[model samples]
Target chain A: MEKIIVCIKGVPKPGSIKVDPETHTLKRENMELILNPNDRPALEMALRLKNTYNTEVVVISMGPPNVIPLLKYIYALGADQIILLSDRAFAGSDTLATSYVLAKAIEKLSPFSLVLMGLKSIDGETAQVPPETASLLGIPSLTNVKDLFMERGKWIAIREMDYGEEEIEVTPPIVASVSPLAFDYIRPPSLKRLLEVKTKEPLICQVKDLNLDPQRLGLQGSPTQVIEVFEKKIETKGLVLEGSPEELVEKLIEILKDKGLIKF
Target chain B: MFEKIKLEDLSKENILAYGEFYKGELNSSSLEILSPLKEIAQTLNKKLILVSLIGSLENIKDWEEIKKSLADEVWFVINEELKDFREDLYTEVLVKIVKFSQPYGFFFPATKIGMSLAPRVAGALQVGLCAHVNNLEVKDNQIIMARPTYGENIIAKLISKSIPIMATISLGAFGIKYGEKEPSIKEIIFPEDFVWKSKLKIRRFAPSKKKPTKLSTAKVIVAGGRGLKNKETFQKLFELANLLGAEVGATRPVCYEGWVEEERMIGISGVTVRPKVYIGFGISGALQHTVGMENSEFIIAVNTDKEAPLVKIANLALIGDAGKILELLLKNLSK
Candidate 1:
C-alpha cells in the first residue's frame, strides 16, 4: 500500500492571540491551541487519497508537548498513525531551521510515496517550509495545489501558476503545499470515528530520535534573525467625502486625481 | 553626517519585482512594488532593475512609462517559445539574472506567480527568503522585511545574512508613490540559450465573460459583512454604494454565509483595497477582514458593537445598527 505523510501544525486558536505590552512578543500563555487552519486541507486531502487509493495516512507535527492534543484531533479525522517530533532543541526555530528538522524526520520515515502540507502555517505565513523541505529532500514539489486526482498510479493535480491553473502529472514521492481555499470542500469527521480514535496515543519522537545534526535543528541553526518588532502606527488620518450621489462621484474623482490614482 | 554611497556601492541593497502576468498586461501589484523600489533606491544609492519574461514587450503599452518610472534599467527575457509561464523557464531566467547581477535583495508580489517563483528562486540561489512581507526598510545596513504571520495577527520581521535576500510583498501593504525625478530606462535582451521546459501545456485562455470590475482600485468603497443579518438588508448596502458611486465589498462572513460572492470579500485572504473613502456597514472589523482596507484614506464604521476593532480604527464611529444608520444617512443625503 502507498504511504502518505501530511504535515500539521498546532497553532493558537482564532482571535485568542495576545501581544505582550512591554516586549511586543506574542503571549502564548492561556491561549487556546488547535491545528493550523491551512493544515486542515492537507489532512483532508490525505484522507481522501487514503479512502480512494487504499493508502495509509500518517500525520506528523513538530512542536511543544502541548501539541499532542492536536495530533489526537488529526487521528480523529482518520489519520492511521501520528508522529510528534518534539524536543526543547527544536524550539525557537525559524522556517529554515524547522524545515531542517522536518526534512530529517521525513528521511527517517523513508519509503513514503507522498508528502502533503499546507501552503503556509497561520503562525508563520512564510510559506517557505514546504518548498524548503522539498529542496532538502531533493524531490519535486508543487504548491497552491487546488485539485488532485489519481490515474494509473500517478497523481494528476491542478496547481495555481502565475496567471492561471497548470495541470501536471507526477509519480509518488512528490511534495505538495495545498491552499486554504481547498478546505471548504472537506467533510468533517463523523462522531463515531471521532470517539473511536479519541483514546489513541500518538507516537512521539525527538530530535535525537531522528538522529539530526544537533547544530542545525534549532535557534543556533537559523541563519536569519528578527532584530526587533514594533506595531505600525498610522500617521495619516485621510480625507473624507460626504454628499449626494453625483456630488460624491465628483468628490471621489477629485480625490483620486489628487492622489494620482487616476488622471483626468 | 550621512555617508555618500555611490550607485556602484553594492554593500547591501536589492530590488524585487513582483512577478507580473506575461500575456495581457503588467500586474497592478508591480506599481505598488515600484513605490517602495523608488524609496529604497534613493536610500541605498543602488541601481534598481525590473525583470519580466513575456511574449512581447511591444504589446505592453506602458512598458516605456513603467521602465522610466521605477527601474534605472529594465530587463526583458523575451521568448516566443516561452509565451506562457513555466516554472523551469522562469526560474532559469531569474536564477541567471540574480547570479549575474548579484543584487543584495529581491522582491516579488504575493500573488500566485510570486508565491511560486520566490521559494524556487531562493532554493536555486540557496539563500533565505521572507514571503508575504507587508513592510520593507533598511535598518542598520540590513533589509528588515516585515510580514503578518499567525493569521495576520502578529508581524514577523526577517533579516537575511546572505546577499540577494528575497521577499514577496503583500498587495495593499504599501501605497504607490511616484517619484518627482524620472528614471533613465535601459533594456537588456535575453541571450538565445534561455532554457525552456515544456512540462506543462496551456490548452487555451478563456477570458471571463464579466470583466473584473476594478473594485479594489476604486476611490470609494461601501462594504457590508455578516452583521447585516439578511439578504434584504445587504441590498441596502449596495444601494448606498451605488448612490455614492463606490464599489461594494463584504467581509469574510458575508461571503461565507452566501450573502455575497467570494470576489466581494475584503480581507487578507481576499483582495487588498486602499480606497479614498471606506465606509463599513455592519462589519465588526476582524483583523483578517480589516487589514485589506485599513489603509483607506477615511474610514467610517457603522456597527452596533461599540468595542469592535473597526470602531476603534474608524474616523467616524456611528453607534447604532447598520440598517438604521444607513437609512438615516441615505435620507439625510437625499436632501
Candidate 2:
C-alpha cells in the first residue's frame, strides 16, 4: 500500500507560552504541549485520502521524547504509524538543518506517494520546510495548498494565490504544504475510534541511524545565529479623544477630513 | 573620529536585492525593502543591485523603464519556465543566482512568495535568514538583523555568521528612496540543466471576485475586530465603510466567526494593506495584525478598554464601545 507521510511538530498550547521577563526567551517548561494547531488540516487531508484510497498514513515529529504524546494524539485521530526523529545531536537545528534531517528521514521511509505538512508552524512560523525538503529529496513541491484531489494518477492542488486561487496538478511523490484556509474543511475525529486507537510505541531514529554527515546534523549545520532576544520597546503616544459615541464619530471624521481622508 | 570598519568586512561584494515588478512597476512592498536595503548599501559603500525574474523576454522592456526612474543597477532573470512561481523551480533558479553572484548582503520582500523561497535559498546556500526583518545594524563588519518574533512580543537580533547575510523584510517597514540617473540593466538566461523531479502544472484558477473593497489600495479602510460581538454590529462597519467610500476589513477572529470573508481579514494570516486612513474598531493591535496596516497614514481606534495595546499606537484613541461608535458613525454619515 502507498504511504502518506505527515511531517508534524509539537507546539506549546496557546495561553501556555510564557516569556522570561529578563532573558525574553520562551519558557517552555510547565506548558501543555499540543499538536501544532495548523497541522490539523494536513492530518485531515491525509485521513481523507486514506478513506478514499487504501493508503497508510504515517505522522512524524522531531523533538524531545515528550513529543511522543503529540504523535499519539495523531494516532487517536487515525494515523497508521508514527516516528520520532529525536536526539541530543538534533537539537538547535535551524530551518535548513531541520529540513535536511526531515528529508533524510523521509528518504529512509522511501516509497511515499505523498508528503503533507503544515504551511507554517506556530512557534517557528516559517513555511520553508516543505519546499526545502522537496529540494533535498529531488521532488516537486507546492505551498499554500488549500485543496487536493487525485486524478489520473496525479494530485490536483488548489493553491491560494495572493489575489485568486489556482489549480495545479503533478504526479506524486510530491510534497504539499497546507494553508490555514484549509482548516475549515477538517472533519471531527470520532471519540470511540479515538479510544480504540491502540497506541503503539513510536519508532525512534537517531542522527547516526540516518547516516547524515556528522558535521551537518545539528547546530553546527545550522546557518542562522541568534545574537540577542529582547522585548520590543513600544513607544506609544498617549493621545486620547474624549466624547460621546456620536460626538466621537463626528469629531473623528472631522479630523480625518482635515487629513484629506474625507470630502464634503 | 570615525574610522573605517574592520578588515574582514572590506572584502564583501555589493548588496544584491531580490524582487519582482508587477504590471510594469515594482510593487509598494518591494520598493519598501529596496529603499532600506539601498540605505544599508550606501552606509557600507556598496552598490545596490536589484535582481528580478521575468516570465518572458518582453517584460524586460518594462523593467528598463523602472531602472531609469529609480534604483542603481538591475539584473533580470528571463526564464519561460519561471514565469509562474513554482516553489521547486523558483528555489532552483534563486539558488543558482546566489551561487553565481556571491553577494555579501541580500534582501527580499517578505511577501508570500519571498517567505516561501528565501528559506529554501538560505538552506541551499547554508546561510542565515531572518524573516520579516525590520532593522539592520553593522558593527565591526558584522551585520545584525532584528525582527519581531513570538507574535511580535519579542525582538530577536540575528547574525548570519557566514558569508552571505540575508533577511526577508516585511512590507511597509521602510520608505522607498530613489538613486542617481543612468541606471544599468543586465540580463541572465536561466540555467538549462536545472533539475526538478516533476513539474507542477497549473490547471485552472478560481474565478476572481474583483472585491469592491480592494483593501490594499483603498484610500480609507474601516476594520472590525473581535470587539464585534454579533454579525448585526459587524454589518454596521460595512454601512459606515460604504458611506465614507472606505473598504471593509476585519481581524482574524472576526473572519473565523464568519463575520467577514476570509479575504477581507487583515493580518499575518491574511492581507497587508496601507490605506491613507484606517479606522479600527476593537482591534488590540497585535504585532501580527499591526504588521499589516501600521503604515497607514493615520489611524483611529475605538475600544472600550483604554489599556488595550491598539490604543497605544493609534493616532487618536477613543475609549468607548466599538459597536456603538460604529453605529453612530454610520448614522451620522448616512444623514
Candidate 3:
C-alpha cells in the first residue's frame, strides 16, 4: 500500500500557558498540551486520503517523551502508525534544525508518496518547517493549501494567495501544508479506539537511530539563536467614559470628529 | 546564450534584498523592506543589491519602476521555466545564486511566497533564517532581529550565526523610502547545463468575487467580537463599517464562530492592522487579538466589562453594552 505521512505537533493550550511578567520568559511547567489547532486540517486530509486511496496514514511528531500520549491519541484517530522523534539532542531545535531532523526521519520512511503538515503551528507560527523539510528532501512543497485531492494519478492543491487562490498540480513525493480554517470540521476520535491505543506504546526514535549528523541535531545545528525574550509593553491612554448608551454614542462621535476620523 | 561568469571576491560582502512581483506588479511589501535594507547596507558600508527571479522582465509591468528604485545594483535572473512559483525550483536557484553572490545578509518580505521560500533557501544553504521579524538592528557587526512569538505576547530577539544571514521581515513594519539610485541592471540567464524540471504545475486560479479589502491598509476599521452575541449582531458591525466607510475586522473568536471571514480576523494568527481609527464592539481584547491592532493610531473599545484587556488598552473605553452602543453609533454615523 502507498503511504502518507502527516506531521503533527503538541502545543500548549492557549490561555493555559503563561509568561513571566518580569522576565517575559515562557512558563511551561504543568501547562496543558493539546494538538496544534492548525495540524487538525492536515490530519483530516490524511484520513480523507486514506479513505479514498486505501493508503496507510502514518503520523510523526518531534517533541518530548510526554507527547507520547498525544501520539497515541492520533493513533486512535485512525493513524496506522505513529512515531515520536524525541531526544535531548532534539531539544531546543529551531525551525531550521527541526526541519533537518524531520527531513531525516522522512528519509528513513522513504518511498512515501506524500507528506502533509499544518501551514503553521500556533506556538511557533513560523510556517517554515514544511518547506524547509521539502527542500532537504529535494521535493516540491505547496503551502497554505486550502483544497487538495488526487486527479488522474496527480495531486491537485489549491493554495490560498493574498488576493485570490491558485490551483496547482504535482506528482507524488511532495509536501503540502494545509490551512486549518478550510476544513469545516475535524472528526473526533472514538472512545473505544482511544482506550485501546492508551495501552499501546508509541514507537520512539532518538537522534542516534536516525544516523543524523551530531552537529545538525539540536541547538548546535540551529543557526539562529534567541538571545532575549521580553514582553511587548504597549502604553495606552487610560481614559474611561461611563454613560447611557445614547450618551456614550454622542461622546464617541465627538471624539471621532475631534480626531479627524469623521467630517460630520 | 548564457555566460558562466563568476565574481570571486571573498573580501567584500553586500546586502541582498529579494524583490517579488505580485499579479504582474511589484509587490509593495517586497519594496518596503528595501528601505530598512538600505539603512543596514549603509551602516555596514556595503552595496545594497536587489535580486529577483523571473521568467521575463516583460511579464512585470512595473519592472522599470522597480529598476529605478533605491539600490546599488539590480540582478534579475530569468528562465522561461521560472514563470510560476515552484518552491523546489526557486529554492535550488536561490541557493546557487546566494553561493555565487556571497552576500553578507539576505532579506525577504514575509509574504506567502517569501515565508515558504526563505526557509527552504536557508535550509539548502545551511544557514539561519528569522521569520516575520518586525525589527532589525545592527550591533557589534551582527544583525539582531526581533519577532513576536507565543501568541504575540512575547517578543524574541534572534541572531544568525551563519553568513548570508537571512530573515523574512513583516510587511509594513518599515516605511518605503525612494532615493536617487540609478541602479545598474544585470540580467542573467541560466546556463544550458543546468537543466531542471518542476514537478509542480499551475492548474488554474480563481480570483475572489470582489477585490478583497486589506485591513492592514485601511484608514478606519470597525471590528466586532464574540460580544456581538450572534451572527445577526455581527452583521451589524458590517453595516456600521459601511456607514463609516471603514473596513470590517473581527477577533479570532468571532472568526471561529463564523461571524466573519477568517481573513478579516485581527489577532496573533490573523492579519496585523494599523489603521487610523480602530473601533471595537463587544471585544474583550485578549492579547492574541490586541497585538494585531494595538498599533492603530486610535482605538475605541465598547464592552460591558470595563476591565477587559481590550478596554484597558483602548484610548477611549466605553463601559456599556456593545450591541446597543453599536446600534446607536450606526444611527449617528449614518446622519
Q: What is the C-alpha RMSD of each candidate to the true structure, in Å?
A: 6.3, 5.2, 2.8
**Residue-by-residue lDDT tens digits, candidate 1, B1-335:** 11322223322245646437557487777777877766776688776666667776556667545644566655565657557765545776777777666786688877767776677677667677776676778876667877655564455677877677777777766666555556543334455554555434454444445556566788989899767778778878777776677888998767756677656778765678988888788898876777789888878776777677787788766656676666655664456
**What value does the lDDT take at residue A179 in candidate 1?**
69
How much does candidate 1 score in TM-score? 0.82
Which candidate has the top score in TM-score? 3
Please provide TM-scores computed only on chain A for all of the candidate models, following their numbering: 0.85, 0.88, 0.92
Instruction: Estimate TM-scores for all models.
Output: 0.82, 0.88, 0.93
Error of 2 at B123 (Å): 2.6
Query: A114-219, model 1: which lDDT tens digit per residue?
Result: 8999977766667778877876676667788877877676777787654556677766677889966765677777677689876788899987689888877555
Candidate 1's error at B68, in angstroms? 3.2
Per-residue lDDT of model 2, residues B1-335, tens digit only: 11222222222377877765533345556666777777677778787777777676565345444654345776666656666667677777766666766788878887767776677677677676777777787777677887666655556777776677887876556656656675576666544555533287877867457753477677899998888678889978877776778899898767766787777877665567788888899887777677678778788889988877778878889988898888777666666
Worst 10 residues of 3 chain A by lDDT: A20-29
Q: Tell me the spans in candidate 3 whose CA falls farther than 4 Å from its real position.
A: A18-29, A234-236, A260-264, B1-12, B267-269, B286-288
lDDT of 3 by residue, A50-106 (tens): 998899998999987767778888999899999999888776688888999999999
- Pairwise DockQ winner, candidates 1 and 3: 3
Most accurate candidate by DockQ: 3
- Residue range B1-335, candidate 3, lDDT tens digits: 22323333222478988887655667877778888888888998999888788876577788566766778877777777777777788877777777777889999988888888898898888888888787789998889988778864677888999999999987666657786867777765556677667787888977777776678788999999988898898899888777677899999777867787888887656667898899999998876687678889888999999778888889889999899888888887887
- Runs in model 2 deviating more than 4 A are A19-25, A197-199, A234-236, A241-264, B1-12, B21-28, B59-61, B68-70, B189-198, B211-219, B230-232, B255-258, B261-276, B295-297
lDDT of 3 at B127: 88
> DockQ ranking from best to worst?
3, 2, 1
lDDT of 2 at A109: 88
Please state the Cα-based DockQ of model 2 relative to the true two-chain complex.
0.57
